[model samples]
Target: MTTKVLLASADERTLERLSQVLAEADAIELVQVVREAANVEDALTRHPDVDVLVVDELIDSGRGLGVARTVGAANPLLGIVMLVDQAGPEQFAAAMESGARSVLSRTSSLAEVVSRLESVAHWVGAARSAVSADARSGRAGRVVAVAGAKGGVGASAVALLMAQSLVSSRTVGLVDFDLQSGDLAAYLGVHTRRSVVDLVDIAGEMTGRILRETSYDVPGGIRLLSAPNDGERGEEMTARAARSVVNALRYQYEVSIIDVGSHLTEATAAVLEEADVAVLVVTPDLPALRAARRTLAMWERLVVRQRSAVRVLLNRQHRRNEVTESLAAKIVESRVDATVPDGGSPFESAMNTASVAAASGPAHTAAAKFAAAVVGPVDDGPVDAVEEAYAEVAGRGRRRARGNDAGQSAVELPVAFAVALMVLLLAGQGLVWGTGYLLARNAAHEGARTVGLQAWGPSTPGAARADALDELSGRWRSAATVDVSPSDVTVHVVAPTVVPGVRLTSSVSAPVQREH
Candidate 1:
């Protein structure tokens, strides 16, 4: 059978090179060629039977790999091969995460290119055949990774609550990928010795039975996969193992929620790359906003995910917070998709009692709505009604609070006025003192200049003193004193300020220039 191939590249030289090379191959037929990322989808639509897609890494302004990721997710059975300028571990990992079956350098020999093309074609054929035979084949589950911008941002709580919110409508699996500081199990008040680390070695061949044995059945029908108790054991779950585990989880559940904690690691990178929705949880503060930006930048640099693809969720949102949804979005350069309000005491008590399932407050309701908004289309009928009802009650409380504050303001206004008046008077008095100091310093300098001159300057010590005193004017002339000494050739000036008995003084000395 001839293997159909689609070649996509914006570079004409690359297109000519690939076309020439592919023309010599007898078994491989180039069915379609697309120059832009936007046109690749249409080309695929035209040629649905194409077995392998070979894409230039620099196509579509260097978003070719991201395009591949979108295409692979839509057509999981299709085979993809990325043509990179340089092929290394980083590029290979990025390609794999993008759903490409293989990555090859653009400079690969004709024989190597043909061989890889054939190999990917063979795998695609086998995969399609297997899916055709299996009656249980269905759409894989959606994976949502909840990552904190910094520690204490409540990523674990959000993950658990989101899972709990989703379990009512879908099968939800919650995994603690925090490694050293994972507390998903403790959050639910459950103890389990087995964790995800136990299945790392066998993740590739993970079965439903094996997963059941390793996972715990927590409240609200959430499948809980706890992290290892020992932090050192986290190293055993490598990136490869993390990817395999995610695949298995996707196959088994309708929705998998992984709390990747605040820190990024090898394993978390794999999880983040695999997640369908990567939600970054951040507080409405400057430091948390900065951390969120840094985290998104790191993901982009590593090619783990695109910055535009990340959803930023604002936690601890309050009416009085200086940072709003629009402001935060501006700061992070991403849209603020959803927000969880401050839950107050009821929310805190629920976590303390290990009864998050029973937590009922504005925050809990908002969290559920946030999960719905992030995961799938939200039904806003009931959500709007709930919000309206909360707003009305909150409105009445706000009015009462304003009334209480009015009384306090009445007492504070007089004190504020008095303080302002005192500050203005002190400022004017300081200005007068500064003028006195300047006058005294100028008189001293004038007298000193006269001592160093011979013919043109003041002739005697008394004349020098008069020159120094003349520098002062207004009230300063009578209040100020100037002294000149011919023996030491020193001059001094003193002046009184607006403040009674407080004086400003200056002194200067110059060598006497006697006739040589």
Candidate 2:
């Protein structure tokens, strides 16, 4: 019998395009085109004969993976392929961990799509044959969870960059589990109307038809299953639903990187249980360190019992008052896994301009080092004395803040200054009126005047010649002048310049103030 394939996507165009591509393959049959699973239970109930299920990375109802898991759970023998915009190694790895049979990028050529479909079909066929030959073999794939101990630890940034870094050698899928306030799509520079929430309602009946309608493909072949930007839907996910999603992704990609949000929600905990490696991200600050310590303790009490792997990463290591790696390790009661340096002014400038790829200088290098550490040896280098001193200062600062919260408030005052400046600038343009021009002109004139004065000697006839000219010009301009002696005096333009459209100008004299 010809292999029955179901295509699910958010875009009708994508569905039509993919349907057309699959139609060209003689061995595959386009069985269905669904925008989403029409209730996870029902979708599986209705499509019992679907040999292969193709889904978009983003499904409606924030439950695309739930649909995949539902299908996979109901029919373990079924083959599943996820259509992603980009297929980075980390994301592909995550997808495989989620239970996907294969993953294809939407940006890939029609030929590539066909090839991927054929490959998935072949794999499914071969796996069935292999199962008969050896029924006791373990599954191959790794799920890595990138989680922040607290908010603003840059966990998502690390996860996405790590996923992008892995694309060269591995197939990866990036799952944004933040549900609410998830910025994966924005970070990846992808805009899609449909998110995982849209898939939940129809997740039950999701065939290939439903999966094709929702996912957006990104560049470099990394598949992103983004969360709804609306924080309201965060509670929409249940632990069971989250696990379903993760399971579905496992079949399609070899590795999966889940950006677990700050809080260890039940849904996230479900994912953590399945993850092979859990990367706990934190900064060098006291609050972050405390949170990391608590989180580590909690995980040790909970998921660590299951033998789930965990690693800690320190981000923004170059801050002037940051805790030393040694102190940070001691606080967490574990050795520091890796340190990501702060990508200075240029890096932040690129991020401000919304050019993540351009801002990826230090972040890229740090990500490579981090990847190497995760995959290789844990480098335990000696702590620098300077770093220890800084850590001592940081610890004192934390203690002071804890005592009275005064230092914390004081530290936040500068941020207020920045906000106030931004508000003033935005509210009125005249706030900085002539500011740039005045600074530029003052610098230029100061340089020129210094050169001119150095060329003339004090008490010399040439100096007198210059001073007399200056006195005459000052008198002409009616500027306040004080005589040094016979010729020179310092002139001050107390009022606005008399010249048309000119501003204030002031002068200081040395020996020329009392010229002989």
Candidate 3:
């Protein structure tokens, strides 16, 4: 089919040039020619069959780029091209950000313009076809908002893994919506030249072609729309832009995973509004649980989505007795849908290699499998996906610690008993050891005084030593010794171990009494 084209240029000479180029091009027909950017949209409405829009940089009384951006956002499926002379890197970047599918130099030959138009037209057609197919099959895309119940719960990482798993059998769009500080590019090992910041200006025009230009490929067939490395740049994405971009992805891909970072914001909230499922990743700890509970309550109060739409994924779970699945669900006031084993070693390796931990190696297979199971093998389409996604783990709720006194004491009775037993054992040992030490020390002092008496000599020292041994007459008595001299006497005693393998020693000395 011949490609229908529209030309918008306030400059009469520029219009003549574009018209002449189009007339000479094969398989391209000039359908509408508007000399003003302000009149561009009306022309599109009149010529609804127009396939491509070629806008000159000088149109709209120097607001040509603004018009292009506006038009692109409203008609995302429409092909857009920016014609400029000597577009530097900055200008080219700006042009792309304004939603131009192709930016060509105004001085380019007719052949080059024809080739560019053909390429842009082809991509536009493909994008429209995909959306049409999605409509015909009643398969609106699934959107998963991976939101952290609290910071450092591995929500971003889980989001990435979910996308990776989903894309294994389907097309997935993984958007890094963590505007302030997202590292999706680093995680995917992608040195991205563009980011979501670039798409904000033309978010309304977020067609498949725009996604292709903004995203990078990662290891798991996931297309990543990286967040701005510069936090300040991230401020450019408004809530409307977020909604537009996410909505387009919802229509284009089978599944779209948005990394909403560990906390919430207007930008992230915009994405979450479209989520069929908000996988709230929380660590299995009391602090994280408390934070998650607060966050859930906030979500409910805000009425962002139904509480049922929120899926509680307790990540990095271990064998610790502190935070069980039942306990976490009770605390968070939500069902614990799934648990991901803390594959610490493999996780480190994956992050180092900038690959997905679940798909890194054999060691990470379990993590990968768990990710797949949670995200699901079933496709999310032809209906709302969250309900089905959650059905797998919803009803398996174990009874919470509920009863009089919250059943807390009953549940912890065993643990409390164990701890009490340990404390008693230690305190008992200390008492016995203290008693043994005091007795031994007293016995040694008594013996030293007895041997130091004027009438006592080396021969009589045995009697005193016996008296000292009799002071305890227990295991500690086995190693008592007394030394006598002309002027003084000394007694040494080895205190027996109160607790096994623990021994203490004591010694005492006294001046001998003499006639002088």
Candidate 4:
């Protein structure tokens, strides 16, 4: 467990002092000492086992921090401690931004320097051990890359929920690989101090512990590696860094969902290269489909990923969308894997609340299906964890929408009637109400099913709801209201009782059948 140290300083006196101090410290081995910033790289190359790099503030004609950045990028596992004349806030921030893990004043006592070295050594030791353990396990997780044809296409939502859905059976990692202008942190309502940029430097030695340290452990069993809040720092995540980070994620988590954002860059292209399942999210519109085609072609020409390897997902699609899935697939020259119905208000509300699980209605259902498509299908034996989570939240919301009237009857019968007569009337009313609820629910499902079965022409939701209502009895039809969409149908029935204004309401939702 000895920590190998490399000492780099332009000042002879500083170098001698630090080398002698580190060499004398227990469990610290001074493997290399260099007097120039330029020579540090060679020293590290010669001593690959070196864990810590102690650099002076003015090395190689005042390029000390520059050298720190270079070596840090080259050897991510190498702990960096910068020695400066003044360890002020500015100096410390500069050192950290340059990839130095810690900052120390040259005037500090040897004891303080040793304490700092040991602290850094502990982190490096744990990180290296985690990496070693992961390598030994020989486990590689699946990578799913989600790219948007254009902005505002709900690609980020898809990526976020996709990760959410997989958490039932596996450890999922959601990476905001968009680098510049990435908003996963904002979407999740989390502000992470460390980001993907932190891992870009240490990606080669990334482990579960390191990933956890640099990522925000979300509430629902997801680890999110956010993009840099400062958009300018995104340039640090180069193609090589992206590849290394994605590979390390694969070794650490059971599944990783990468949101590559709308614009494709070298870093994002690197992610696409590592993806086992690559999807381009596009709305059912001519402009989006054209953009998707161009993006696929660019990916092909750049040799980042093959066009055929990418699957197209239609977002914000309507039953009578101008661009059909088949037409869009033909336009993009890729298979349209699935379509997500326009979620309308509930979906928007969930996004605003930063809770994907709170989303109800057709959008949530479609998101679960999309996750299943990417990560394999969900079993029918039991309630799926993702679906169950959504349903639970939706149920709570619905309950809140209704008053706390549990254990109370919807209608109160008069005490003036005979007991037997009242019981019989109440029983009859209950039967009628129950029958009406069932009929309305069945009609809603029928509406969705009929809309899905249409192939020859566009089937509007209005027509579908009307046709389904026609199948119900006149009494039930008069009291039922229906709403239909490509993803599902919802129906609400108000069963009237003998007393005026005394009624019972029942709402039901069913999935809309469609051609897969």
Candidate 5:
């Protein structure tokens, strides 16, 4: 990004010299000159892209401090330069209090002034990049925030995977804002000495160069801004610095993903508010669902009319007779955009190797849907159909929930059909057992008759009984026994049970008679 600068000074000589010096730098473009402090506001308004404000300490008849303070307060990311005749402790303090990064001697060589300007320009560009489009103009990076309703809910995994999905199409930045217990780095099997904490610590000297240095590349194409390696350093990062770093990331990447782990922090609110799609990743569990309800409620209460961007995502889903995605969403009073299948052995292998798994099926589909919620099509290819369907249902549900007949929508056809299918399967199993038992009984009776007839026929009773038992054995292979005597024949059979280690039995017999 080319840095835009507004040079303000009462003296034409100062303006001319500064303009000439800034013009010499390829990275900076002099937007306009502010002749007076009163004109500073108008100049910035006229050139909204101006990132740095260069003003003489004596500008506006010695009101430079007031102007710098006022402008700095409005645009915290803007870099301010104080031109001093002689630098001193008092002067430096005043300059900084007024939001200047550093003070440079007025009589400093053109080289020094140019160098200072370059530094300011870099920070200005970074600051400009940091803000979302909703916060500022010229940048349109889509921000997606993945936060857990509770710890260990896979928010970091969701965030990393979502970012990875977008990498094929756009530059992505994945930030670990979990702070205290950030395990995002561990998930990817990569570690970095520098982190977002480091960026925030040097906020005063923050520039594009500094911000880029703190980011580390992971196995996936996405760049990672991890939490501090030393857990104690989390508290050291302040909200203001985090804000700056976020804005810089917004400008630098096409999509920015933030993993704000379970607990709500001072900085988490800002990221959530700025995100285009703020996803609350939770499992279909009581604790996580409860936390999700609390978090979403709090967002509504705090942000006021800004909850539209919020989405609830269920992760690490497993097939259970009792758990359903719709139920979880209903309990949380939100829509479930997607249910990510459990990572399973693939994820476990990745964990062991410190790398990402090429997880297909549900995991891949969920990540693709997640990416589509906040970003455009991948590589100009179609967005995931599942995401499109999720989006459609969510829109309809919201509209239906708002209308007078909201309760009518509760009978969701899909959920109803799922329940119906389960019922059908259970009923079908009963029929299977009934038919098997009936057939077994008939076969046993037929066997008994054959032996009973033979006992009165030309063949010997033992041969007839053996033949009957063999026929019964083939027809009803489950289990069977036969007994024959001069006057009667009896047969017993056992059928397989629906469940393991259980069986169903049937019995039949016939009386012996003269050959008929």
Candidate 6:
């Protein structure tokens, strides 16, 4: 039988090119091609028979990693292949981290693309066989997290859609732990009087009935543990409390999808530690990429120190940005596991209305495809060290930008001083002049021996005149003449002669322009 495949990408050229390549493959059928990430969920909703998903490395709006994770967590049996621009060890590693079964660079030959499709088709068949066996064996509960590398990467949106996809046949639970600004309950249009706080408050007394009672039902019987509307209560849900809630739901639900808010707070860290799998969400922007890099580094450190399973997701991918899946993976030193498309205005509308299913436009279809991949079959492999290193470097770079200051204080201080000088020259002339004079004097006094300059004024008139001229010439690197009769130098300081924080003492033989 021919394998049914879905394509999720933001670039028209890429989609057309890949579709043409796949069309030539006799073993694969291009069942659907979605332009937006949000449509993936709807596609899965409408066509439950898709065997594999070919997604771009980056989506237009949400993080591609998040989309991939959502797909993997929701479907767990679908074959996922991420399309990246450049092939590198780091890119490949990040792709795998995001839950992609395979990575294909856009530069691959059409024939190679066909060959990969055939291979993925075979893998899909094998996965289906394994899933059938697992079903018969009655062991299929999985806990997955949709977490942002930083805040606002759309992890919650991905979680909502993933839960929606699984609600059809299996018991799926959506837990929102953003606490302060969670939108899970609002997205599902469920008003829960009870929340994770309630669960935490009744930790010892928790029961299946209590959980069921607190959870609000969405379309297709998916249950949602809505976050407390009160920001203070949400804040009170500590990492320990979140762990308790997740552990409780793990026993009763077949699939538990979590929306971990941005920031590795104690609560989020706790969730990351306990989750069977984590989807690290990021965007194409530098800040998001940097955060994702840091998040990955933190996860690796935790893994080495504590052992955890973490993945990556790229969201809001567009064709215009400099940051592509390949570049992102290279920077973060990991392969992109999956990707989603830009969901467009339709997604925003759905988000506004508080309905995951209502977002059932084109983007939802793409989301469903991702969801299928999440619950589908997968092959576990060892973590890539190169990817980890890249993540470490990128994470370190971000930390430095955020004032990490790891053993480079001396270097940073000089650079910072230079920058301050430049800023003063451009924006604060009066303040800069006053501050620069005082600073320069102090620096000259401190490093006088190094620069061979005198620190104080001379006592005798003749000596003072010579000393002033010498000091001015030495410090300012400009000619200075002393008039013994005149008290001070009328010497002019030219442009480029003034060193930052350097004071010039001089007596001029002739009147001159003192360029301040």
Best by TM-score: 5
Q: Go through the candidates in order and give each one's C-alpha lDDT.
A: 0.77, 0.63, 0.71, 0.76, 0.68, 0.64
lDDT of 5 by residue, 1-516 (tens): 576778888887777777777777777788888787878866775787776788788897888877786677455656788877788899888786555777777677667876787777665543333233223332346777788988888888778778877787788989999888887787777768888887764564453445566888776687888988887888777766666676667657778999978777677777776667788898978888888888888878877214456777888888962568988978888888788888788776775675663444568677778677657654343332223333444566556545544355556755755665555444434433433333343344344445545535556566545544543322255356666666655656664443578665655544543456
Q: Please give, for residues 4-58, the per-residue lDDT of candidate 6 as tens digits.
A: 8899999888888888888778877898898888789668757788888888877
Please provide, for model 2 over 160-233, each residue's C-alpha lDDT reduced to its tens digit, 9 standing for 90 to 100: 77877776666677888887777888877788777766666654333222333466667876777788878788
**Alpha carbon deviation, residue 105, candidate 3 (Å):** 36
Residue runs of model 1 more than 4 Å from their true location after superposition: 1-138, 377-516
Query: What is candidate 3's CA lDDT for residue 11?
Result: 84
Off by over 4 Å in 5: 1-139, 304-306, 357-361, 378-516
How far off is residue 61 in model 1, in Å?
54
Using lDDT, rank the candidates from best to worst.
1, 4, 3, 5, 6, 2
> What TM-score does prediction 6 earn?
0.45
In candidate 1, which residue pairs get closer than 3 Å at backbone N, Cα or C atoms, i.e. clash?
none
How much is 128 displaced in model 2, in angstroms? Answer: 8.1
Error of 4 at 118 (Å): 35
- Tens digit of per-residue lDDT, candidate 1, span 1-516: 999999999999888888899999999999988998888866876888999999888998998887886676456678899999888999987786566889988788889889999999987775554343321223457799999999998889889888988888787899999988898888898898999999876654454545777999997789999999887888888886788788778757878999999989999999999988999999999999999999999999999889999988899899999999999999888889889998878788888888876567787788889888777852222222212333444566556555554556666856755675455445434434434544454455456556655444355677667666655543557666665665333334443333578665544443333443
TM-score of candidate 4 on Cα atoms, chains taken together: 0.49
The candidate maximizing lDDT is: 1
Stretch of 10 with least lDDT, candidate 5: 129-138
| Alpha-carbon deviation at 14 in model 6, angstroms | 78
